[model samples]
Each structure stands twice: as C-alpha cells, then as structure tokens.
Target: MEFSNRTRTGTHDSHRTEHDATRPGPMEEAAAVMRCIVCGHRAGYNRAVVDLATGSEVGGLCVGCECTAFGVSLLFGFRLSGSNCAFCERDGHYAIPSWRARTVETGGKTVSTVEYDVTEVTVRLCDEHLERLKRVAAAHARVPGSVRPSGPE
Candidate 1:
C-alpha cells in the first residue's frame, strides 16, 4: 500500500494543517511488533514469526515460549501463534511459502521476468487444509501451460 500526506493552509489565520491518509500508522506498527504471534504474549521485539517449513528467515520466536528452536524443527511444523490458517480461521500449524513466475509485455515483445513475492502475513494452514493445498499445488504443477503466463500475441 502507498501513502501520501497532504497539507492545507488557511489564509485567514495562516494555519497549516497536515493530514495522513495512510492506515496503520507508526503506533500500529509498533503495537503489531509487540504482540507475539505464537504465545499471545506482549514481549515487544523479543518474539518473532518463524517459518516452520524451511526454517528460513521468516520471522522471530518468543523468548518465553518453548518454541525457541528457530529453523531447527523440520519434522514438527509450527507458525506464529496469532497467525491463523489461510484456508480456515483455525490456529496455524504450518507456514508455507509460495512462489510464481510470469511474463510481462514490454515494448512490442513479451519478456519473461522472474517475479517473486512473499506473503507478509504468514500463510498458516492446518493439517487438513495444508494437505488439500499441497494436492492442488501438485495438480497445477503437473498441468502444462498452467504455470506459464499467457503473454501478448
């Protein structure tokens, strides 16, 4: 999301007014950072949102909780506490990262660009929903032309 600030001046009193049209101000960001996603504890920057799958630099882990094994638990997948399942609102048991590539029309020809996007809000999924998503992803991968973008003719 983009944000811009607007300022207006009044001639009568020569007063300047400033207004911010963006949501989630600094206070909100700070509050979000303070809240722990795993144990619902307010430990400020001590807690992190860790990825259970690859154990990559997804986020942080709670210092108080027993989930301090950052990037060490591959067999038992776990996501941040506050994060819910993408498919369902249930507690997120696993964190999955999705990647895709596409072709864009540049000038008169189509150019393939490696577009990568990671979800800011972790995609937490329950066991049942995770299995379903895996199956769907597998099916799509098997289909030819499904993964590629339909560029300009």
Candidate 2:
C-alpha cells in the first residue's frame, strides 16, 4: 500500500486537544477510515503498516503526529517501521520525511509546493543516524528561506 503524510482522527494515548494546523491533502479520506492509536485525534493514517504497539495494522500516523508526538519525522509521508536500519544493519529507531519544496511562478505569483525526491526511501535509522539527521534538519530549518512548521496560523 501507499503511505502519505495524511493525518487521521481517533487517538490512542495522548489527551491533548486535536491540532490540525497544517494544510490538508488527498489523505483526508483516510481520516474517516482510521484513528491514531497514539493521540486519538481521529486523523488519517497508513493502513499498509502495522502499529507495533497494538499490532492493529489499520493505520499508523501522519507527518505532524510523527514529529510532535513521536519526535521522529516521516519520509515522504510514510510512517517508518520494520526492524533494521536503512543505512546500516543495526536496528532502526527513527524516521524522517525528508520532504523537498520549491517556489515557482504561478499565475504571476510565487507558489511553494512540497515535492518528493526520486531516491526517497521509507527506511528506518538507528539512534545515532537519526539524531544526526534531526540535528541537521534543525539547523537547516534555522536558515533563511527554510520552511519550518509553526503553530496554527
């Protein structure tokens, strides 16, 4: 199945109020189908993978939930799971959705769109690599022109 950065409703553990500040995509349909086993937000999720905690396998998580709730970003909207690391043979711990964006001229205005890379992979990473990648992503977000996730606008 395909895994995208779409959020679903219905949470699993978190009691915090629902927050869907970002934009929505085609995965909106998934929100009605599955709920997050962690936050219980009743948002969208991935049905292709299994939820290691309950083994329900119905839905996984969205990109925002993956970051705020789990601290592990998703890669191309995919919820990372499995056993081994994509970089090394060691066990995996974290996943990042290494998304790309670019501003283009559309209708005489600049529009930014999230784009995917050709080599994007939904592989897990060890703590060592995940930490490093998180650090780099953080640093990159600090740079000017970088798109960083902000609170509800």
For model 2, how does the per-residue alpha-carbon lDDT over 20-43 read when each residue is reduced to its tens digit? 424353333434455533333453
lDDT of 1 by residue, 31-111 (tens): 354443333444333333334454432432233332232233422443344457765778665554322234455454444
| Model 1 segments more than 4 A misplaced | 1-81, 97-120, 148-153
Task: Identify the candidate with maximal lDDT.
Answer: 2
Model 2, position 87, has a per-residue lDDT of 62
Per-model TM against the reference: 0.29, 0.33
Clashes of each: 6, 20
lDDT against true structure, model 1:
0.39
